[model samples]
Target: MNADFPFRIVGFDLDGTLLDTSGDLAAAVNHALTSVGRPALSVEEVRPMIGGGARHMLAQGMAATGGCTEGELDVLQRRLLDYYAANIADKTQPFPGCLAALDNLTGRGVRLAVVTNKLEHLAREVLDALHLTSRFDAIIGGDTMGPGRGKPAPDPVLAMVQRCGGGSAAFVGDSVYDVQSAQAAGLPVVACSFGFLQQPVETLGAEAVIDHYDELIPTLVRLGSAA
Candidate 1:
């Protein structure tokens, strides 16, 4: 282990923070929208609707195109998930410098983990497709904790620490849900400015913000040093 590195473990949120999944996600949302005669939304229009789970994202899309009954939303959500699973990696790639940043952490002997609001199976599928599943010591998904216990609930974040065998840890993410979950788990969080932001990245209340993956190591080092 690198004694100079203060953090022994680091957890990441998958979608926007680790990978740019907007293309496939937007396609899935559009598929559901057009299936019921709703107008298709542009990728830019659908970007902010991500971070939340597929059902929540689809609901926002449904509302944007045209309001839907709960029943319709239920049906459309399944379709969205099914479509997304099949095309999860079509346009998804790690953000610039993401792989390098992860490698730096791993080289320092920092245990890496993924704590995402995405379902376990889907998260696994996407990571496996990208050949990234081997990098993380733990992969905790929204469903891994059970119904109603996803991010913003702190359950998954806590589970990440446990699964990683416990250590001084920190989180990196791109959403309010990520900040809340990490904070609630008593870890400092760094926000990604280039992520799928529903609001200003500064307003997410993370301890620090980085515009690119190249800044990740420095940011985490500063955060750890300050701690």
Candidate 2:
């Protein structure tokens, strides 16, 4: 309802931003660890290890389990992915007020997109399982562009803008990667306070932070107007 809102495209990170996927992601991490004779990790224990991607999350779990060989990690990574794709939505759901917030944005003619470090098929699979795939105007994953150019780099963020038909954009996410990427892309970012903050949320260096999705639109209005 704030007509002065300046952004046209609003991009979001998938895992910790829009959806609370910590439960299922932790299960996949624990499954991979236990198969290699390592102990299982609790969901709360694995919360901070997420966000980068499956391999990064598994690496953290493996490191906690005393580490494993590169070849062993390769096999375990595949195993983790399989299990995660199989049970993608078992414990995953949109964060409280997320759908309503998205509805508000859509009604305001803002284009919505998802740009995640999650692999393409897997991100789409999880979105499909939740029947939420139709919500976004675009979905770009880690592998969608190329290797090593996912986040903390401007490639995918630029791609999000291009794919959304080129307009002033802002990104919403829950991690340093998200902040780093958006800043690199020359866009303002809003961090989610309730997300899987690996460190203190203040450390992310975002323009604004919201404790809940209900605050998102007003936060965006301020961020956009200030820009």
Candidate 3:
């Protein structure tokens, strides 16, 4: 580890960074589509839409179904949320090497936390289902932290730092929103190459882009040293 690096806490985005929840999310989207008399989206078709919140996913599903009026979309969004909540952990799992990477960090005395745009209940359900609830020192979801505090804003990441006892921190995520949030929080960020990045990961201005969880420790060490 780089002795000069000031980081003590590492905040991760749940869905794309640590867990591969695309399968479950796609299933829920298709369920909503079927309920609304629309065609189901294939797994590949829904992968790119996974990082955003349920509203964004529902909006994309609506567009795919030829666009609904705002009121109609609201109904569909509610239904989609219900359906997704019912199936929250049907197929969710940690990405390859995620548990090992987290374990290494924990063993080395680094605090770990999750800051996600996902609904708090669902996020906790997925983590519990994957037996990962015990791994985090803190978990902040979009709904639990009150309004005016989601991704693309520094509130959630900053809150995570405060919850972890307030120290230097890093945020790991896969989207421009995460990059922006980390920047706003004045935290170094590591972007995941395999997450649902809508644009090139390099364009997000992350300190490093990691293709695998196994690279996390070494990258952190390198970044910490540089810092």
Candidate 4:
């Protein structure tokens, strides 16, 4: 939406965008539920509830179990977090072309960062597991730098840009939350159709919607050339 900025720094959403981590996340959620004598959620049921944050995911999981009281939800959330922490990398992995895309972007001199609602420690673990920890110039997690606002608020994305020297940046992600955050930050948004978007990716009002990471390099190149 912000054509004046064009593109320089590229920020990414972690969970569903770069990594297909539903398998492990769902497993952790179910593990927590089982520990508390609750039922487990199927992978499909847990996938859509992701991207918001761990509390949201835990709330959804508890809701699926016929609603827990406020205190109960808090207890469940803590247990789920502990379980998730222990199994963060069980079956989690980067989506196809994610690493290649990061490599290509870095090779082409694109400044990169990650802005996500995931917790910093868990996010770091995922990136480290994929050996991608060094690829990003910055990683702004949900709980990083205190409990600032989360996605759907521009704070995280804007913070990433500010930390990366505040040049032209593009936010790349899979959901409406990412689009909204980018817009709020006055950055152009790029939606990836291949990620876990709850609705059609086109509805996010991004500057462009790409289905593959390989398409990203040429798109940014075209934007740079145009600028």
TM-score of 3: 0.95
Residue by residue across 1-227, what tens digits does model 4's lDDT show? 23433466899999888898899889978876787788888999888888888888888888888777888778878888888887788898888888888876666666789988889888998888778888888998888856758888888898898888877788889888899988899887778888776788888898888888878867766655655
Residues 184-216, candidate 3, lDDT per residue (tens digit)?
999989999988777888998999999999999
- In TM-score terms, candidate 1 sits at 0.99
The sequence of per-residue lDDT tens digits that candidate 1 reaches over residues 1-227 is 79998898999999899999999999999989999999999999999998878888998999997699999998999999999999989999999999999999999999999999889999999999999999999998888989999998899989899999998999999999999999999999999999999999989999999999999988989999999
Residue 206 displacement in candidate 4 (angstroms): 1.8
Model 2 alpha-carbon drift over 4 Å, by segment: 1-3
Q: What would the C-alpha RMSD of candidate 2 be, to one decimal place?
A: 1.2
Clash count, candidate 1: 0
Instruction: Give each model's whole-structure lDDT.
Output: 0.93, 0.93, 0.86, 0.83
**How many steric overlaps does candidate 2 have?**
0
Candidate 2 lDDT, 96-152, residue by residue in tens: 999999999999989999999999898899899988899998999999999999997
Sorting all predicted structures by lDDT, with the top scorer first, yields: 1, 2, 3, 4
lDDT measured at residue 19 in model 2 versus the true structure, 0 to 100? 93
lDDT of 1 at 24: 93
Clashing pairs in 4: none
Q: How far is candidate 4 from the true structure (C-alpha RMSD, Å)?
A: 3.2
